[model samples]
Target: MPSPADKLRALLAQDKLHVMPCCFDALSARLIEQAGFGLTFMSGFAASASRIGQPDLGLMSYGEVLDQTRNIADAVRIPLLADGDTGYGNAMNVRRTVAGFAKAGAAAVMIEDQVAPKRCGHTPGKAVVAREEAFDRIRAANDAKAAGADILILARTDARHEHGLGEAIGRAAKFSELGADILFVEAPRTVQEMETICRELPGPKMANIVEGGETPDLPHKELEDLGFAIAAYPLTLMASAMKAMVHTLERLKSGQDRTADLMDFGELRERIGFNDYYEVSSRYETSRRD
Candidate 1:
């Protein structure tokens, strides 16, 4: 497999906007790569939801996120970008957080300008740190790449909620000045606001199209026309999966679910790659017995 840097370089070279399906764990990451996605993101909301069995309320720890990053990195050949929430602390913490994710074999780490225990970007009652202090975090992240790790740094601004579109754009510009490789401005409410950000910032921008969020849905061609470098459709896969699982459970309770109604076991086994997975998993066990 090519190195993470090798894959990331290809992602950066694309003339069109690259799209990554956000994944929460190794199984999802593997499936995404097999499904032909060039990149995958370790989504903070999904990670917290899956890992802690709760909402994304800053409950997940730094080490836990890194562990998820490493697991996904090990399981897939494509580039993985993990969310580094608030860089795990202040500007100094941002330095260590960058190195930690790089050492974990991630291609990119996204840190927001928010205080610890921060809420989800789309959630209300959000707050941001002082602009000057937050920019320092970006500098530390740019400076803290592990040796030969080619890790990417994504600067995310949550200023769009408390502040306005103009403030978000201003912060994005400053983050770009502080050497952020990509700028993610959270929650643009309208297409005009989106277009303004694209035109205003000297940015390598990332667009988020989450269903039922603050961002209004636009066509792929429209998003591409707005100068986005990368776009992510997070939550769609998980939401669909969750709905199917719940419906299956309901059917089972009603005694309507049966082998005939279920998908073929063989087909599922093939899709999940059970044979290939066991082949890799068996090596250590067989060696130990030997």
Candidate 2:
């Protein structure tokens, strides 16, 4: 069987845009796979919210993030791209972070240029490291990949927040020069800026689409026309799930029927793998042997 990295590479090779629905947990990852999506990213913002009920202010520890990655990766056969925020430290830390995610069964790991204790890409108070430091992070991540981590390096830049789009593109170009497998330019405010990013960057590029966030939520076809390889919906599923849960809670509090707000129990069981588990375990039944 092909490795997860191999599968991701194959998808990137195709001359089309892939719609990636980001997942926060193993169940969400399984749902994405069952929905027939080709790829999914483990969004740090969503993961932090779901796991700890906190914001993505770089509060989640390295171990916590890696454990989440392992569980989500193991829960699905499709490739998982993990969020390795700031590499958790310096360039040396970048190496360990990259290798750790690979060992955790992630197909790719994203290393960003944000400073330690990074904020969400769409949020304010975001700052990129010095040009040299930013380059070092991608260099170290690429070095880890070269040393046989068997994973892809997703080089991300948040310079557009503090600096300008020019600076962001410059950093991403250097990352590509340093051998990043994918390039992500975060939060381009205008369609023109998005166009410039795709025109200037090389190799597979990912566009992050956060609902009610910095980047415009363009349709997949338009993003493909702009030369993007992947269009990532980082918060759509999480936001929709949250809305449904809150509505259900409100209905229950009002003494109203909540069945319409829920999934069927039988379908939920199958989605969670209970049906498959029983089928596979039947071969070991003691009664069958008798």
TM-score of every model versus the real structure: 0.92, 0.98
State the lDDT of candidate 2 residue by residue for 22-123, as single tens digits: 999999999999999999999999999999999999999999999999999999999999999999999999999999999999999999999889999998
**Who wins the lDDT comparison?**
2
Residue-level lDDT of model 1, residues 11-101, one tens digit each, is: 7777688877899888888889989988988889888877888778789889998998999899888899889989878878888899888
- Go through the candidates in order and give each one's C-alpha lDDT: 0.84, 0.94
Candidate 1 stretches with Cα past 4 Å from truth are 146-149, 258-263, 277-290
C-alpha-based local distance difference test score of model 2: 0.94
Per-residue lDDT value at 94 in model 2: 95
**lDDT measured at residue 25 in model 1 versus the true structure, 0 to 100:** 83
